[model samples]
Target: MLRQVQKQMSLHSILYNKISENHILKKINYVVDFSFINKLLEDSYCKNFGRPAKEPEMMCKLLFLQHLYILSDEKVIEEANLNLGYMYFLGINPEDELPDKSLLSKFRTQRLEEATLDEIITEIVRQCVEKGIIGGTSVSVDATHIEANTIRKTPERLMKHLARKIIKTYEKENNQVLEEIPEVPKYKEIEDHTEAKAVMKDYLENVISKVKKNIRKDCSESIKTKETIEKAREIIEDPKFLNQKGVRSIIDEDARVGRKSKNQEFYGYKTEFMMTADERIITSVRTADGAYVDGTYADELIEQTLKSGMKIEEVYGDKAYFRKPILNSIEEIKAKAYIPVSESVYRIDESEFSYNKDSDEWECREGNITVKKKYYKIKGKSRPDREGYKYYFEPEQCKRCPKHDECAKKSARKILQIGLNTIEFYEISQYQKTEEYLEKYKKRASIEGKNAELKRFHGLYRARGYGLLSVSMQSKLAAIAVNIKRIAAIAASKFCIFTLNIKIFSQYYKFCLN
Candidate 1:
């Protein structure tokens, strides 16, 4: 039942006074406003049905405490019971009973959806902005992988195990045993794992076909058998059903294989963050399957930040986000992009030729090259226009030049072909050489520190639950915990400064009176 009434206590309760003056939790309680939480999550609950539910605000506070202290659900409840500060933070009286660990799990998985969690995060950020903790003018974006809660296994092994499971289910459902159950093929003698995987795939396919045919012919069939067949078919249809390190995990199908470096790989999901530069507070977060490239969601992240009412004047990222589409999206929002140019841009050295923007011409030491716009055509039909500039050097001028061999490697005319990105690339390259751009670009490093803080302090390096939805919930809560901690620290600092100034003024006034 909802705890709507505050418990009455003695006027001079020792526990109440002690918790009221606690530094960290006290500051957090004052700085964070949880009154809006219940209203925001009002739609998640039924107004007139079922037994009375736990207060949504208190449940959310419990989740915040869980991530803030890096405690499991059971551990968090235990700590809250033992510590007066935690109890006070949650507005629970000393004698009030705590909810069960199972209830906490249900709240996250069943009550709170991803969008609701996102709204909670947005509200926290809005409060921070109102308190002057976040500048909201610039944000840095980056992604990190959280290890999924699953064991890594080869696709061939996983597939064989799945097939065996299906067969077992079919056998258990019907009261009859199969005449022959296909044995898992042993590839121990095969030195090449790839070739062994292919062999197992063929064997499993044959076995699955036989089992399906047998099940279809049977007069008595159960729902379990039908579901098993459907799952088996899904496995067979997957393109990487039999390759090594292809299928992510049997336990958690949503997680995928992500590469951390050229030599290191992990099975998990990627958590992307857009954090404001001033306070290092995360403005928006998106979780994706680990296999997704970091640059693929750059536009979406920026859009989400904008939708959260954070006015972005500039955005910063690494070379991975230096794509044409991403750059254009940032430009469309009229925000300056501080992303570094890709290494490919360095190869196009424009120092040898001077560009005249008005004439759209490139002037060399001895010859002038004019640009011609080119379009694409396929099968004698004009396709959608793909605009690119083709700048060709005078063949006669190049033949007479002293650096002809260095300039032109082929017998054909010296032509440089580039799309519209060439202009953006040149601009970024020039901007990168200036001190202003370098100073602004340095802010992008703060997001790396935020990522490290999450992994090291909040236990975000490894997911606490399986599946994408559970992992995403964990991530959002971790971000909220981090923001709350930051806000508390900032508020405490200001309080200290104000107290010191008041004491100094009182001392000065006493001296003047004396």
Candidate 2:
């Protein structure tokens, strides 16, 4: 049954009271508002269940502590049992039994969904915003990699393992030994990497086909064999089962190969964050497979921030986000973008061409001829015209120009593709050349520090668990802990300032009255 413990002046309580008041746990307990979590998770529990569940708020605090101190589940529970500061933060007596590590894992995987986690983050941000700790006007966006928890395996080893598993399962079900399993090709036989990869893929496909044939032939003999065959079929049909690059990891199929530099490659996922520039508060976060490009998800991240009730006046990002669609999305929301233009944009200098909005024509530098607007099918397909406007210069005009050779090759016309957000792009490009843009763009540097903090301090460089969902949960929890710590620091500083002002006022009043 759910019950609240009665207040008592126990020895542990008196000792906690006598402990230093400047402890981080004491400061966090004084400032942070964790009560909202109880309401947020209220619906997750059943009124008529088998047993009264552990309080969700306490469980959330446990998770926050886990990331805040970068402790493992076992270590966190053990520390909570032994440390008075941890017990004080949890509002539990020293004798209280701490929850087991399995229960914490169950709470993370079963009780907390992505939406609930998001809600908790949003509520925390809201409180900070209300208290003027975070200004929601401008935000910087960036992404970092988190290594998955798996050991790298070669294609040959993975294929052999799969084959062996199927063979053992078949033998165990039928109570009969097979003559021999499929043999994997040796690496020495294939000299070229590409050729070897192709051979391995073909061999695996053949093995799967043979296994299916055997299953169909033996289905009538044993139900167990049929069940085994069905499970094997599901594994083979899984989209993440295998790819051209080979299996990323047998343990975590969702992870993909990611390269930070030419020399640094890892198997993991990518986490993107949008944080307020003034306070470094994380506004929104997204998790994707390692193979996803950083620029591809800017639109979604911006939308998520907007949905969380933050007014985005401006966005700052690196050149990785210098794509047409991303710039257009920012303009659609009427927010300014501080992203630097890519070299491709500079190649087509807009200064050389004058656009006529009324006639939909672009006049070249010579002003004697105009480039005509045209729409061509992209990639030789007929449907869904391209997103931007393509302008083609007259071949005759280009041929006569002094810079013809520099601008275009012989028998080729000069063409420029301008997106519908061309005006916005031009504005951004011009602004990038100004002092204001440079100063504003500096804010993007802070997100890099936040990424470093997440990796270096909170253990985000490598994921704590396998699978995309588990890693995503880890990212969110880390973000929450960072925000909570930031809030606590801000609160402590404000309190110090307030106390100093009060003391000064009291001393001044005493002198004036005397």
Candidate 3:
């Protein structure tokens, strides 16, 4: 059951009203209405039965303050209990009781879902759109890395730790120590990592096999024992387990090894978002493992922004978003993409050959037209030039050409792999020299500042807890807090106050001086 919390008169609230009326929280409270939170998350609670729970709006407001000031769960409650402005913002009297810190964590992990968090952002952006805060049709997309909370371990050490955990669990469940356990591998004695990994793997497999044979068949197994055995088996069966780093941590398995640059790597997750070009308000956000690509969520971000009633006319990003599918998706919505072209992916020499658009073939300087074409999909893990076409000329034509010695010296025929979007990319590369593209591309720099703000002030530089869910909630709530702050500034500048209704504002402000 949802408990409806109503503000009542109190001597402490009366004494502190005058000093807090001019506070920023008071203006924020006047500009934004948190009542939508309860209604948005109304389905999360039991409406007919059960004891009354803390007001969903109040709990969410607590979260807003937590991320707004970058305070921990326990620290935010202690600060809220002491600060009158926080109480006023939360719509609680000075003497009212607050929930414990554990409840805040529970509310974050259990009561809230990722979809609800996205809805909260959408609703806030919707308010901004209604208030004329976000009026531009241009949006910028970018991503940043967040470090994981667990300590990273090497392959040998990780395998040893997992094996020890299983052995300990089996011993605890069966209440008897194995007399003939496998001896620990002397990893230091081996100089080769591959040999050391193989030895450690063999030792772990022996431990697992020995434990399975000793289990009593007449009784059911404990959940912990079964899970540990399954995990060991899964790790053993993975062909690429030793080839990649940071796949399965003893603590956080969801995190992976991602790159900040070619020379730099990080063990954690990535947060990608879309923000309005003019107002700098984040419209949508997505979280993935550290190795996630930058522009994988462009379509979803643009769709979310459109759903919030904002028209998107132009999209801007770095070279990572210059894929054919992403460009086609943006073009489908009648929006132009201003991403820079990656020279490595779109480089082609146009002096020797010309493309025939009507025939979909290329002609060389010697009048040798392409006789055959096949779609060549790049195999393996490399992403550069993934999909393209290999244009092949007639063998006799190539062998008879004067330039055959230079173009096809060692091959039977001359073959050229042209990028799928080479022509469109060439046009975009030409457009990059114009004034319009230069001026609009300047806006992309703002997202970098926004990323720095998220990392420096809002505690998004590192994960507060393990897993993707907790970090995602942290990121979206930070966005909401910043949006509220931005709305307050815009409202004060325009001398316009925004709220759901005048009645709710008056009820909260009746005791304060004008």
Candidate 3: tens digits of C-alpha lDDT, residues 1-514: 8865565667777856565444768877765677888988878899979998888888999999999999999999999999888888888888888999999989988888888889888888887788677788999999999999987776777788888998899888878786688899988789999999889988888888777777655264656877998987786677756876546587888888889999999989999999987788899999998989888988899889888999999898998888878889899999988899886668666677777767877788888999888988776565554777899988888878888888865555588777778866766777897998899899889889889988898888999888888788878888888777777776676553444456668877985754
Candidate 2, run of 10 with poorest lDDT:
1-10
What is candidate 2's lDDT per residue for 1-514, written digit by digit as tens?
Answer: 2224434546657668755677778887776677778677877777565576777888888998999999999999988888888888877776778889999989888888887887788777776777677655998998899988887666555655556666676678777776545677885577786566557656666666666677677764656545655554555565554543435555776788878877988788999988888778887788988876887778877877776677888888887788878878988999988888876544456667666666767777776355577655454366655466678778887778788886665335577677556645565677688898788788888888999999998999998888888998899899988887777777788789999999999999999999
TM-score on alpha carbons, each prediction: 0.90, 0.85, 0.85
**Model 1 TM:** 0.90
List candidate 2 segments past 4 Å from native: 1-11, 173-176, 213-246, 261-264, 295-300, 303-309, 328-334, 344-379, 382-384, 387-411, 414-423
Model 2 TM-score is: 0.85
Candidate 3, lDDT over the whole model:
0.83
Q: What is the lDDT of candidate 1?
A: 0.78
Q: What are the C-alpha RMSDs, in order, of all predicted structures?
A: 3.1, 3.8, 6.5
How far off is residue 249 in model 2, in Å? 1.8
lDDT, each prediction: 0.78, 0.76, 0.83
Query: How do the candidates rank by lDDT, highest first?
Result: 3, 1, 2
Query: 151 in model 2: Cα distance from truth in Å?
Result: 3.1
